[model samples]
Structure formats: structure tokens, C-alpha cells
Target: MKRAGQQGWSTTEYLAILTGLVVLWRSSQLVLEHLAEHHDEFSWALMIPF
Candidate 1:
């Protein structure tokens, strides 16, 4: 649906947004792998304070 003054994203804008999302996804994957490999070190993270 097109709005009166709002326009669709251009090719460059679309590509930039896509690239940003890819970067974030890839970074999260890497962080998750690292955390998994060092799971023991992060055990304290499960502790909750009242």
C-alpha cells in the first residue's frame, strides 16, 4: 500500500538495510558460538538478585 507522500525504498536504501540486517545476524551467530564454547564461564549470569 502506497501512501500519499510516503514513497517506497530505493534500491540503495533497500540494499543498505539488508546489509545491516545481515551484519547483525552474522554477529549474533558468532557471539552465540563463542558463548556456547565458554558456557561454564557464564554460569554466574543465571544468578538473580532480589
Candidate 2:
């Protein structure tokens, strides 16, 4: 079904969403780099036997 006057996201909303995604990606990159550099201090998750 469709509506004649229905509208989708505006340009500003799209830009805001894109900007948010970029921030999240960059933050994750920084965190991962930090963790990798200090690999000896932090350990990976251990798997327990079922």
C-alpha cells in the first residue's frame, strides 16, 4: 500500500544519520588501535566449555 502525500526522510536527517555513523566508526577505530597497541595488558574473551 502507498499514500499520495507520504514523504521520506529529508536531506538534513540523512546528513545527520551519516554524520553519526562516521563518528561511531572513527571512535571504534581509535578504541581498537589503542587495544591492539596494549595487547599484552588486555586479553581476549575466554570460551567456556558447555
Candidate 3:
């Protein structure tokens, strides 16, 4: 049925978005750590995210 197909599509879309968010969060943590160690060098750049 059309409703079942739509549900399947939505489930896949939800999973894709969830995965993307996890990847972004992990990368952001890494970037923040690196910037923290070199704070003086990227002080202005850090403001963009904040």
C-alpha cells in the first residue's frame, strides 16, 4: 500500500538524519579539542561557531 511505502521511506530518512547528526557531533568535538589546544591561533575562528 501507498501508506506502507511512505512509512518505510520515512524510517530510512530518519535513520540517515540520525547518522549524520552523530557524525557532526563527533567531528565538532574533535575540532573543539584541537582549537582549544591552539586557542590563540584560531580565537576569531572559534567565534563563528559560538
Which regions of candidate 2 deviate over 4 angstroms?
A: 1-9, 44-50
Q: Tell me the tens digit of each residue's lDDT in model 3 across 1-50.
A: 47988999999999999999999999999998998899898777757964
- TM-score for each prediction? 0.71, 0.66, 0.65
In model 3, which residue pairs have backbone atoms overlapping below 3 Å?
none
Residue 39 of model 3 has an lDDT of 89
What would the per-residue lDDT of candidate 1 be over residues 1-50, giving only the tens digit for each residue? 77644454565688899999999999999999999999989978888565
lDDT of residue 36 for candidate 2: 91
**CA-only RMSD, every prediction:** 4.7, 5.1, 5.1
Which has the higher TM-score value, candidate number 1 or candidate number 3? Answer: 1
Question: Once model 2 is optimally superposed onto the true structure by TM-score, how far is the C-alpha of residue 18 displaced, in angstroms?
Answer: 0.2
Stretches of candidate 3 exceeding 4 Å from the true structure: 40-50
Which candidate number would show the highest TM-score if scored against the true structure?
Answer: 1
Residue 7 error for model 1, in Å?
A: 11
